[model samples]
Target chain A: MSVLVYTENWDGVFKKLSFELVSYAAKVAEMMETSVTAVSIGDVADDELAKLGNYGAAKVVKVDGNTTLDNQVYTGIIAQLAEAEGAKVVVISHNNTGKALAPRLSVKLKAAVGAGLIALPSSTEPFTVSKKVFSGKAFANVVLKTDVKILTLAQNSFEVIEVGGTATVEASTATAGEAKTTVKDVQKQTGKILLNDAEIVVSGGRGLKSGDNWGIIEELAEVLGAATACSRPVSDEGWRPHEEHTGQTGKIIAPNLYFAAGISGAIQHMAGISSSKCIVAINNDADAPVFESSDYGIVGDALKVLPALTEAIKEAKNK
Target chain B: MKIVVCLGNVPDTTTKVKFGDGTAFDKTGVQWIINPWDELALTRAMELKEDAGNPVSSVTVVTVGGKDAEPTMRKALAIGADDAIRVDTDARDAYAVAGQLAEAIKDKGFDIILTGIESSDYNGSMVGGMLAEMLDVPSVSAVSGLTISGSDVEITRDIDGGKEQVSVATPLVATVQKGIAKEARIAAMRGIMMARKKPLAVVPAAEVETLTDFVSFELPAPKPPCKMVDADNVAELVDLLQNEAKVL
Candidate 1:
């Protein structure tokens, strides 16, 4: 019997989220009185797989080749492996890949699943876990009645732990089935920080007035080394790309620092960013909902306040 | 091409969220709207159908909800779905919802299925993927762009740092976000009048076992009111950010 952790690997290496998964699964395995096994698919080096032991995996299983991950194929493989290993608990990251697979695995395994989980199980008896609901406005304590359980940990929700150790790597014979979709092209935003992985984010909204005035938001973001984002209205107005929009209908972010300049925090907008650690709002309206949710607020026009704040931060960094 | 656009009725974005006793949510007086994301998907599908010499044959909107949800289904038809289906039951979880949808879709012979990436209410973001897996079809998650040509559909999906373009054969599923359609269209009076004659089937919910049970719901703690600072004193705001908020 073992606790299984799906350690996602990309570009021949394990992602940072994979390390965090092993660290989390290790603790859960200890409580469950079982060893932790890390599962990897696609092109990953053996040495890299072995290094996961540092974060506390007892063993690593690699499903090799340049196979592109399709949700259907990966879910089948993981579910079959879990049953074969008698894994009582399965852990997955609550990111794009995980979100796409976890629910399918739960249904296939007939196991209860808790997704976007913010913390460890409150108790294993009834197998209760907490996950964000109503966007980020609320949390629900969900109890799983099934014998097996699946969990997808929310990004940045848990601390990563590493204890010195080593892991045994085993090459699996599991091959993916035929895929229905084929990749045509991949267009990467090569130079800019990705929103999901960014630690700091600077965003603007309709208050910027025009696409031409977006230079100030970009200048502030550049100074802070933060990814740029925009409100739904800004994206709708075509002032910014749709991928850069963060809100109820857009990307959900949890950056350490979030700057909302010229953005009036609509409830929809707040839903996507409420998880951010520290939100700073610069808006002309004192009554903007962004101020109500932000940790700090400056009552002024974003055009004037943003440049001043950017200069101040630049000065502070110099000092 | 026949398209199945999955819809979910949710409380309006502006609705104040309150938890009821036990496992229930306080839905009293909450005005429901067609989920904004699903509405966007429906609008985009309508645009494709309305274009000159378009290839689309029909647009069907499906949902897992009770009679109270029929109005929302009607709204979907008014917004331009050819027909609507409401599975009569309360949706327990994403898995159960997807199971019901898959059951309804298995015999429909839909060439393409579209759903919002995540519903505004629960934000589970898993149903579309689950449906795809159940039906044994190709699916793209959170697609921002989609173009259909013959039996091949090209989709643009946003990853953490980049965008990927993938092509899938017919009988494809796509969980779409905002960029699939720049704007959602309002129902014209003629569309609304026509929607009255549209077929809306209320099928009994399939007996699928639910995976998770909710014990309770809790609202997030109220944040302290914002501390208004003079706009000119950027230094003070900076100090607060560094010393207090520690974001710096």
Candidate 2:
């Protein structure tokens, strides 16, 4: 009859998505008339787990283990916790870690699970959950009739709320499963925004003509403190790294503000970014498909439009 | 090495989305196809098999969908999968799908399991990770490059801002991301002709766990009309972004 929320961390620090999930779980806990306990696994520090209390978690459960990104080990631990706590509902963030853990925990607990959830459960007979479908092209409502329910909320789907309070931290020990995998090294990208977590994104397309002329795009991104992205053709042409590509065939992203400069929006590209809150397009072709999806459309040469936009951003920030 | 690529039949990315009276999707008139991410996973699996000089004995494609998904399942066969398995069910929930897949493959003795990072339709991106957990194996997600040497697999994943490289033992699961490999080759006329002869198996979905349920579906609010700012009005555009949108 209790609710358990998985508090996600990265390199020992809590991620923003953790707070967002906790905020979301708090609401569900309130509606269900149950207390919410936030759980963190694998070497999380005491002070860090304590921060969960501010987000409405009544208590924080910290399980210490030398953990890698192994789903089996994490799931085993979560299953034990859920069973021990007699949790009726488990809330997790639909990020990399949650995506890996939620389904396994559901299987182990014999609980129903829903992923890509966008909002709190509707207060209806079946208690349906809303989720994004078709790469943000559509929506689907899922109802969980089981006594135990597992829900993985989409990242950035719910607004982060702050309810100032202190969380009680409790240390719990669990059996550690031997990892079948070995991690020899961890190489991380330097000086790049995590594309998924970026608030502002500046993307380019084939209209930039070549890789050498990417300075304008980078400058604009820099001025706006935004992440950089590109269209499929731009990546295929080797004008940008494949990781920078954002489209249906590439990475799908939904940022607060997306500036698509020099790219024609193909259906595939639109499919990936159509969920972005605000879209601005800068292209010479007035009929470009990107214009159709953009909140604001500027019909002009990108080479000219980009520099102007960058300068404008810099000036506005300074003022 | 034996690799299993889990596939899901999903609505085409371009299909118009409509929700029924409840939260479940209205499937009428929606064209179904193999999820695009899963296609990337299958293509990568096939590539790894080829690069290993056919060290891979079998490439199995697994799906949890209804009989209507057989054509899409057959397409995997055309793309070089040796065999296919369709768990007879239309369970769209990730947990149920993972349970069915884990049950079918748990005893299959697979060394590697590959799946798309997320399905284009559900965008759940949960099964691969869950399956690995249920099978008690290590799992990496959003892997862009994978190389196998003996029992160890080296994977490179795109993390926030940068990439992470991990080396794990065999019997591992990986969710493949785009840009990990070249575009998947479409079935050639000859390949298509031969796919009809490939072995396709159907099995009832496992009854393991039930968690969430769909209540109804709702379309996102229609987008507002585009407001064009004259190219000369750059300042006004900036003002709107800063004041109106409050996103600047």
Candidate 3:
């Protein structure tokens, strides 16, 4: 039996999450007493797939194609490869694309699957996996009893291990099913970090008061190299775009550090980012719910707290 | 035109999660609600139906959950769906849930199928994609805006680096994202009163093809104690990040 890691690529370059998954998969493989094989589908270059070796992949399976992530077709291919290689464990990143493919693959392989996994599997019996639950408010460990196991690791959950090694590349011949969806065009966001992948997020709420005053928030985000997010109320008020809103009723994110300035932590807002490793809340109200959920709380006006925090971060980065 | 919105009865986002002996979440004290994203989907469907000048014949909400989810299902009807269906089963995995929805609507002939990008509970975000594949229809994920023109639906989505716009024919599936529609409307008092009278059909789930199983559930390790550094000590904070936490 072998462990299979799904290596995701964008524009011919492997995503950082793919390396993270490989590193985690490598650990799982060691526990399973099997080597890890990294598989890349779509139009990824040979060198791109070869790079998986550095991330602990023993073998690289490159399936040459121009497939645009047709879920059924890709699931069938992965299933065929898993069966042929006798893979006992499969790992994928918990990204948009991975989210689209992993569940179907779980069904195809009849494996117990864990999504939103945030840590490595437990060494204890039954092989439990921990995953973010309730929109990141809490985490739950999932144990798999199935012989074949599937795991979708949350992005940035594990540190990437760089044990550069050579990976044996092999060409796999697999037939892809007809794609039901066609890609007409892809519109790309300009000059901003994708909220889902951002490491540090600086979010605002209705306290910002108006959309015109957003320059302060954007400036802080720019200085910190972080993404900008807003509360549901901010979005509802049209002070910020909906895509920038993060809450229980919106997008759930798990950044390394989340800075909530000029925002009270409503249960809804906390639900989206409670999974953040560290949260710093700067609000005038000491009784804000956000402070209760935050790792650090500063009872002060955001207009003052934000500029000071920005300066501090800038000075720290410069040092 | 007929639209199908797949809804999941999910725990409130703030609910504390307790892990079972195996890797399944404990449902104790968890208040169930319509998955937030699904609410967006339902709202968008209603918008489309209204925009079509009532050309749409029906908007059906479907879920795979026990009878306790009926109230949440009725909430969907109150919000504007024509009817609701609860496929009697506990939603264990994304694939099984998607399969149940797909089978229920296979021959029902829906022009468009909508679901949230991901449920707040499991965060699988794969059900819509899998359901689209199962139904053999074009699919789009995380659509922030949609406009139906003639036989095609123009969808705008937020991608990794940017936004994307695509056009697909009828009988397609799309996952609703934030900003896709206006703020979801609360059930009006009249609608809430009328919801009790709406048709909420309960049916046993068709034999589903199970792909994944939950062996058990456990709580995550407690976070380490937080160490506070003086606000003026920027250098110290940097040192802590680079050396102690090693996050940098």
Off by over 4 Å in 1: B52-54
Error of model 1, residue B238, in angstroms? 2.2
What are the runs in model 3 whose C-alpha is more than 4 Å off? A123-127, A316-319, B14-31, B53-55, B133-138, B209-248
Query: Residues A1-319, candidate 1, lDDT per residue (tens digit)?
Result: 8999998876777766788789889988988889999888887889999999999999998888636667777887888788878999999988878877887787778777788876888888888988888888888888988899988887766767988889999988775577666888888788888887778999999888999999999999899899999999899888899889998888888888999998999988999899899898998988888888998888898999999999999999999
For model 3, give the interface RMSD. Answer: 3.3
lDDT score of residue A171 within candidate 2: 86
Ranking by TM-score: 1, 2, 3
For model 1, which pairs clash? none
How well is each residue in A129-155 modelled by candidate 3, as lDDT tens digits?
766666665565556767888888877
**Model with the higher TM-score, candidate 1 or 3:** 1
lDDT of model 1 at position B40 = 91
TM-score of chain B of 2: 0.95
lDDT of each: 0.86, 0.81, 0.79
Interface RMSD of 2: 2.1
Sort by DockQ, top down from the best: 1, 2, 3
Model 2 chain A scores worst on lDDT over the 10 consecutive residues at A175-184
**What is every candidate's alpha-carbon RMSD to the true fold?**
1.7, 2.5, 3.1
